[model samples]
Target: MTSNVNIDAHQHYWDPARGDYGWLTPDMPPLYRAFGPGDLAPLRTAAGVQRTVVVQAAPTVEETRYLLDLARGDDSIAGVVGWVPLDSLDAASILDELAREPKFKAVRPMLQDLPDDTWIAHAPREDAIERLIDLDLAFDALIFARHVPSLIEFVERYPNLRVVVDHGAKPPIRDGIDAGWQPWADGIAQLAKLPQKLHCKLSGLATEARKNWTEETLKPYVAHLLEHFGAARLMWGSDWPVLNMNGDYAAWHGAARNLTSHLENAEQDAIFGANARAFYRL
Candidate 1:
């Protein structure tokens, strides 16, 4: 918890040649190319980011292994949030296989792409969450605002679950609409009430915003997260590579730093690094 330590708790690196990313289309030039530790190393260094938690982008377990392999060679990567098949009854074995990897701290099932919003609550899925809890693995929720209610319910179902809502649950930033704001805020506040278990990441906000976004336009939404989650539960992440679609790593980190410059240095330390270290045992 030293003041100077900094960790980017969420980021991604993918090579289409290694595993297919169904969502990664050729038109998206920013993401079409492969990214690895070499690309991120200097960006983080310039931004004073000393450690990172690389989360998964592709749904395949092969991709998870790909990332684990990358982590095996990269010391800056403290841990990883890789994917696993939560719908199948064999989830326990898959988790067992994954947990054998020392840096595997969590699982993100890619709920946003699925048709059923409450899929996490159905059948073997709930059992899968219990497995995650039993194995001491965190659950990274890659959801949108619409999934907020079910996400809240899912978390409530497991009091011991450690949850981090990726991308502010993906607010309605593209249209600059406030209609989704209230529900997102309300659900987030409800989740934040689970002080010990629930956490939020300050990331992927710019991409959700309009193509030409500014800190002022994003301040209202970011501030609300800071308000409810507090410094200890709020972690700053570049969401790098994906962040390249909206802005560069340095710009995103600079914006996050500026957004919270009003807070005390210790609180800044938590948002920028300490919280991530404690949350993921990084």
Candidate 2:
């Protein structure tokens, strides 16, 4: 029988005082405060979600450890997608250390913020990356649509590594389909065709579109992901606090459920939970 385990495959909890979150400035009052497991428990329970994969919001080793510490104390946290300076000499060693923590399921570099769009495609420190694959850890590509092409190249070099494109590579929903859909759609289609084990998240779209955006505004993009990756490879994520930038946890969760309602029950089950469990071994 198909398992009824519902998972929010992506989300984050950050304490800005750690000072690693350079992006969380006083200007963004909504996200400037600390967010933790306690803040999320009620919301997830209210939504009927039993577990979540808390991802990294900062590009620092300290932050990764903080997330792990939180995981150690919270059963609701299924896994963590932390960060490692991929180019550092100690990358592999750090991976080994983090891997010792069972909940350190993956690492995600903040690629979208970098000026070099192709950095991920040709990142150095193969030993570290290979070590990650050997340790059976996953890689989360935190990138934008422009990085998709290079991401394809990067994935080609590491076919054995499990990877997932966060936020459908942050599609240009705010720019509207006519202005930004073709390249993103085409690039995603190509990435989906690669023989590598690749996946996409049904997360962050709420924040990508305009604040007033509705589910219909997300229909074409969601449909594109479903068409390319299929429900089995597409996992749902709340993107939480950041999701609060444009909407709330309940709003995005409800929207995702409605968006995937047409699929068969099992397919819906996979997108909502099973795919993440299988991908992260959670």
Candidate 3:
């Protein structure tokens, strides 16, 4: 409804036949359905979102290539943050391959499902992250509350690597739980000292909170990130098909706009799109 240009910082487009999305089950009817760029265009236009950064939902390079190809065919997708085996010995070569495509903006390792204490412990993952930095690629930390400490350590060690905390560290809000989120908030505050190296997406809170979360229910989490990271380092995201777990594209977009209603026009512009554009180099 506002005049500010919007950008969806965190959204996904997937094809089940191409990759394994074991997470999407029949019980999850809304998300188990198909989604594509054509499906997103009307939503984008209705939400006033001029551009989007398509993120990878799968766990393989072939999936990454698929997202890149989608970006190649869709100009509305300003950039793409896909997956790559950061622990692989050929990590640098994979980076080289993706670098050829300007739309390939960053990489994410699905660490949320990994064991609490894995090889990404400290030493090995730190080295791998450094290699990512050497190649000038950004890293998206997709972890839950238990993994926040490791994420903090990684960000501290690789101060130069651009790290965006997806889903506000995926807080357990649906259960009305905030105890586990306090430490995550503390970790984000500490990482915020690195400025551009740290950013956060104001998405996913709706699904995390009550199923039909109104603006009031989702305000606290959004306010926390806005206060901690500020609009300059914060970006708006639809979370798309994942958001379908709670509601549709209109619901998510409406929630986002409602949360930012109190901000100034310029501040809203930064959070809605400008920050994402600058962060992903779109």
**Index of the highest-TM-score prediction:** 2
Q: Find the candidate with the highest lDDT and give its number.
A: 2
Clashing pairs in 1: none
User: What TM-score, computed on C-alpha atoms, does each candidate reach?
Assistant: 0.95, 0.98, 0.91
Measured with C-alpha atoms, the lDDT of residue 171 in candidate 1 is 80
Model 2: CA > 4 A from native: none
Query: Candidate 1 lDDT, tens digit per residue, 1-282?
Result: 354689998999899776469999889998888899999999999998888999999988889999899889989889999999888878888999999999999999899999898877664466677888888999898887778778777777788988898987888777665665766777777778863568999988987887768888789888999998888788998888988888888878888999999999999999999988888877
Q: Considering summed lDDT, which 10 consecutive residues are worst modelled in model 2?
A: 1-10
The superposed Cα distance between candidate 3 and the true structure at residue 28, in angstroms, equals 2.2
Q: Go through the candidates in order and give the C-alpha RMSD of each one to the true structure.
A: 1.7, 1.3, 2.7
lDDT of 3 by residue, 1-282 (tens): 223557899999987666477666668767776688999899889887888888888778888898888888888888899887777777777888998898888998788866654434553445556766876778787877677667776677667988888888777777664554566666667766664458888877776776777777777778778888887788888898788778777887887887888899888888888888788877
Error of 2 at 177 (Å): 1.9
- Compute the lDDT of residue 152 as modeled in candidate 1: 71
Q: Per-residue lDDT for 174 in model 2?
A: 91
Pairs that collide, model 3: 174-208
For candidate 2, what is the lDDT?
0.91
Our model 2 lands, by Cα RMSD against the true structure, at: 1.3
Q: For each candidate, how many residue pairs have backbone atoms clashing (under 3 Å)? A: 0, 0, 1
Tell me how far the alpha carbon of residue 47 in candidate 1 is from the true structure, in angstroms, after superposition. Answer: 0.1
